[model samples]
Target: MATPIQMPSLSPTMKEGKIVKWLKKVGDKVSSGEAVAEVETDKSNLEIEAFDDGYLLQIVVGEDQMAAVGAPIAFLGAKGEKVDAGKSAAKPAEAPSAAKPPPPPAPAAKPAAAPPPAAPAAGGGGGGRIAVAMPSLSPTMKEGKIVKWLKKVGDKVSSGDAIAELETDKSNLEIEAYDDGTLAEIVVGENQTAEVGAPIAYLTAKGGKAAAAAPAPAPAAPAPAAPAPSAPAQASGGGQVVPLRREEPAAAGGRRLRASPLAKKIARERGLDINQVRGSGPSGRIVKRDIEEALTKGVSAPAAKKAPAPGARPAAGVRPEPQVVPLTSMRKVIAQRMTEVKPGVPHFYLTIEVDMDAAVKVREEAKAMDLKVSVNDLIVKAVAMAVRRYPKINVSLQGDHVVQYSTVDVGIAVALEEGLITPILKDADQKGLQAISTEVRELAERARKRALKPDEYTGGSITVSNLGMYGIDQFVAVINPPQASILAVGAVADKAVVINGQLAVRKMMTATLSCDHRVIDGAIGAEFLRELRGLLEHPTRLLF
Candidate 1:
């Protein structure tokens, strides 16, 4: 019988994936657990492995083509198995958006070679003992740290009870139990990291085998006994049945705000302050609706000041022979991108000064309530709202075509040890200040830890880079490719200026907009900045 190799759903948000390259060609023998293709999902690149051993009989989706999740990408069958080339070459249909995952390939009619060894079940009992393994929580995660264990050794747990909090590259997520049982043993301790598909713990039915002190290490070429709990039995952190777990409020500069994981994720993505957003969920638990209502009310928060640059790189004069530093993978990619975007995209610049008196007043008022809003947050809201009016400025150049985005998603540039990453605030124009602040804090936290998901960092028509905290008066920022513009912000300082024909000292800030001439003209970019300046100059306008 022919075994179909379906496109695996790599991430929660991934609908389809592009085949970057095929490792196995037709007529080549393939083994179970062997990587056959490299796929690019919305989040990152990952290798897809074979589940059955056989000859690579057909390639259904060739290199560079995209196939929806569960769509057959290839077929594996016994060598010289008489596959009809015409039928096997037929194009695979796109799986329906809500399609259930395909069932695992049935056992081969006759064995091709020795089937891969089955991973040993933890607890090693014959009856219903189940082995639990580290699951692929998010699309881009390769490994995860066991932040904490929710259930201890020999603790009784019911199906759906959260067993642990796994910290992935993007965020922390909870792991739940599938069957009611007593946790037998902990293989990976708290604070320890494990690769995906590695056994982490075990569970056995009550009154079964006496629990072991520690889970035995996985055997060499052991049977793959622990598959991630099936969808019918498992749920994500934000899934329908919200599992109530005690989460400490996230801290920002010595202040903590209590919010649910879903609420935190939403707040961070929208750049909202979780502290200001009221909670409507049970016992004042903040959820998605509260964040939405806060935005509808048009409440805006202040922006964050940049953290001081680390005490000026210790004097290079102190017996330093030019230090050699190797570029990290992320830094190398950043370098490559800059090389492509800086020269290939023709860039134009526009600079403007804004009277920050009203914005400053707004920040002071927010501070009275202990809201840690920053000036940058206000500027992001203003720029996003302004971009909505000047659609050309919110666009990307695709070949000769200018693609104007419908939603106002803005990217905030965050500098990290391994290069810089811009985690996007999707639909920034529609969010309130509090929401933007929360999101910016979370995204910045994760980006610095090198844990942002692909979609979180990928799409944005414009980006904002603030250097006010570093006291940069003004500077031009290089454009990120495809996007039409990037806004560079400088520090706010008191300066002598004319207010109603009288000389007075007023708070002022400088901002420069770097534009891609292919997608935005000088007039278009200038008009956008004019609206932005007006919004910031009248901070109250952001309230409505």
Candidate 2:
């Protein structure tokens, strides 16, 4: 029997991965659990193994191209078996989110306008008791594990108070109460898993009877419905698809090919050699029509190009094709979080330029002392010290409250291929420059590998985003939520400046602080930057 080998989920949050290379070519595979192909996800490059022992019959997705999770990448079959890869492979489904305006961030339980009360859900009782079910804490969360219960039976629970903690698909978030009541009965125990909307606990009014609820296993299992329902939508959205179409070699008869982006993408995906395909566009540029015609009406494919000489540049007038890259899970989460946090929260940016000559000299001296201090490490140290002097800079703008953290945990933004992740240097103000340097490097390396645990990335009071290494003069960064401020650090380079009275060259850097106006007022943000500039300019102050 011929079976299709589907793309595997390589990382915890990977939606897709690029096919790096196939280790085994067609007719070469024979063992189960053997490595077949290498896949490169945003996190790391890993080899995907074959589960069944069979001959490698066909490659569905080619090298250097991306495939969504569960999309077929190859076909396997017995020796001399005919593998109908096209029939066995499932077509990539169209995304429904593209048609709908981005829904409110999945974390926000209710939309901006809370809807009117519904007829009674699973947990509603007669005596002012509403059932508190296992909540859907993250998008794509089906069932959740209850990490701990915050409120025990007989405890008074206030509306909007966190009653339990759940470990969801993304992160661990608390379950909040919807009505004021007493915790009457715990339906689901801690460490137990329950379906979303299934009763986890029951809350009742004072002297009110508890509601009897059953946490049934049956929710009709809607998981399989997603793959089935999207086929019609995918077929309806005709122009959007490229991978679903199969290709065949035609008789040699067509014009030279210089393909359009759409035509080029289609050709690349379908494994078509459109180099000599007939074109109807300007200057004989191959269009989608040309690709379709070539598949059906044959085209004369151009011979493979000769190898270029050593150190030679790429051919002139040969531009890479512009194609679509779907959003990864990390990117989608980032987009959702940013869209949710950026608006509605008032933001203010403050920029300051500082003399970096002294700090630069100190860094050189540290390097001589075998210290691994870099520009970001210095900024992290400075920001940490600044927050200590002005605690308002290390605060979170919670709803109707400002939380000023006692410890200065500075977050360093590490860029990934698909998105940005921050890993914290806890108690940064208390650590030495060398210690900060080492920790930042380790955190960043792990972050890039997506190996950092949830605790390592979360709970930072303030974040430092440095583009100085990239030679950026200055840029503002959006404040990470719950975080009151983000400091953007630019390059430390020589510039002509007036010191005392004479115009001389000095190392100078620009730093911008983006603040949530609710937590940090304009003056507070300025004062914090002033304190930061003093530390960096003096250099000696940061040594302690």
Candidate 3:
């Protein structure tokens, strides 16, 4: 039987996914559980694995393209199977139809005074011109960057013309013009970032003056009546010099830069000091060309120089040019979550040093017996066991209430190439040392490969973060939200200790606990650590 490969729902909030790359082409033999493509979800990149064995017959979604959830991305059948690829493509349109019910009310949610309907007056005093503001494209988007402007000044734009591309935090999307008119002015140029409601351009009536937001205002109050030149002045090129003047920008209001909207937008996008860009337009007004010239010649504001100290030596060569890269979806979410939890939750820290000599000996003996175990594995087991004893620390702080857990689920922080992911270890307190080690290793491997499912990464009562492999002696970790506490494990090193008035060397390790003060008090956190330390020092208790 031929099986249709549909796009899987990778996350709870994922509406669509981009096909990053296809690993198996048509006519290739594929087996169940084999990765057929690499998909980019909203959070991270993951492999799309096959569920049935067959020959790869077709790929409906190409690379670097998006498809809604349940869309048929590919097809699999026998080697000589004849598949209708067009039918596969047509079936996915139903998914978008099912999703159309939620978006019709979005426009109604905006304020009644939104500029889209009343744009003509906002654009200019005349009814012929229309204002064009940045559109809110996504539910979470607060601002967007103009990737590029497809339409230029004086260009005619009609409804549904893709006038510009916007880069949101999630993905780059194309935006269309709503009204048909001449592009009279471009307020926001290529690469400029603007708020959702901020105006970016203007549209004027056909054959109307393209001057609603044009640069170089006409001179006000007319030419002076008393001014008269008896003789023309000689030009530097042997021609007569002509005096050209323009209205002082202050006449309209306070002093303002005499620049076109596009020029200002370009300056902002390129991080150039507009004041330093020499204007070349009428009355020495700045324009788009001036900005381009400044960028081409690398003209920037002068840096302030400081006197060196008496014995300070001059540094060597010029510094490399700085580069700006946009943040990934995972990084953005991590930043937002961290910012929300840091000041919002009142947190306190507690650090304790543990003697790991006994656990070290046990690990050595286990290695000799062909049983592999890591210090982190032991720490995870210890933390889980301790949580089972002190359920207070294994609880979350909900609004006006505290929720306790019946089972101990520990989260192990695993760092990836771009960001970090925490995979949960369920029922850790009941699992033996060997089982815990196996599960942690498997979870970590899948996490780095981005192959774990949503359930595998969510729902942990507490978190364990170990920096011991990096040779970090001691450090504190931030609390993962919803959970009240997190344990930071440091490297195990030999330290000098005094035993019965005699100096002795011992294996010492340090662990820091960061707890939410709203839920677990200082005494409760300390008690939890004490129990964890006891379990770690006495490894025989873990065996029983």
Question: Across residues 201-266, which tens digit of lDDT does each residue of candidate 3 receive?
Answer: 877754322222111011100111101111112011111111111222122232335565677778
- Separate clash counts for every candidate: 22, 1, 0
Please write out the lDDT profile of model 2 over residues 1-544, one tens digit for every residue: 6675666654445565555445676567557767677665544445677778888665555443455565555667877765333233332311321233443334122211111111111123335344666643323446888889998999998644668877654445567664567898998899998875566887775432222111111111111122333433322221111120011112212312234566777778877776545444322335666678767754333322212212232221121112223444663454456547766555789999999988888889889998878767878898899888887677664433345565677999988786787788877887899899998999888777655544466668799999998999899999877677899888888899998999999999999999876556789899999999999998789887
> Per-model C-alpha lDDT, please?
0.63, 0.61, 0.63
Q: Which candidate is the best by TM-score?
A: 1
- Among all windows of 10 consecutive residues in model 3, the one with the lowest summed lDDT is 217-226
In the predicted model 2, the residue pairs found to clash are: 123-131
Q: How much does each candidate deviate from the true structure in C-alpha RMSD?
A: 17.0, 24.9, 26.2
- TM for candidate 1 is 0.47
Model 1 over residues 1-544: C-alpha lDDT tens digits?
6676766666556565555456666667998877787665555456677877898765555443455555555667887764553133221221121132442222211111111111112223334445566765454457889999999989997644668978776556566653457888899999999976556888775433322111212211111111222221211210111111112222223322334566677778888766656553322345566677877765463112112213332211111111223444663454456547766776779999999999999999999998978999999999888998887677765532345565677999998665666789877877789999999999898787655544566668689999999999898999876577999999999999988999999999999999876556789988999999999999888978
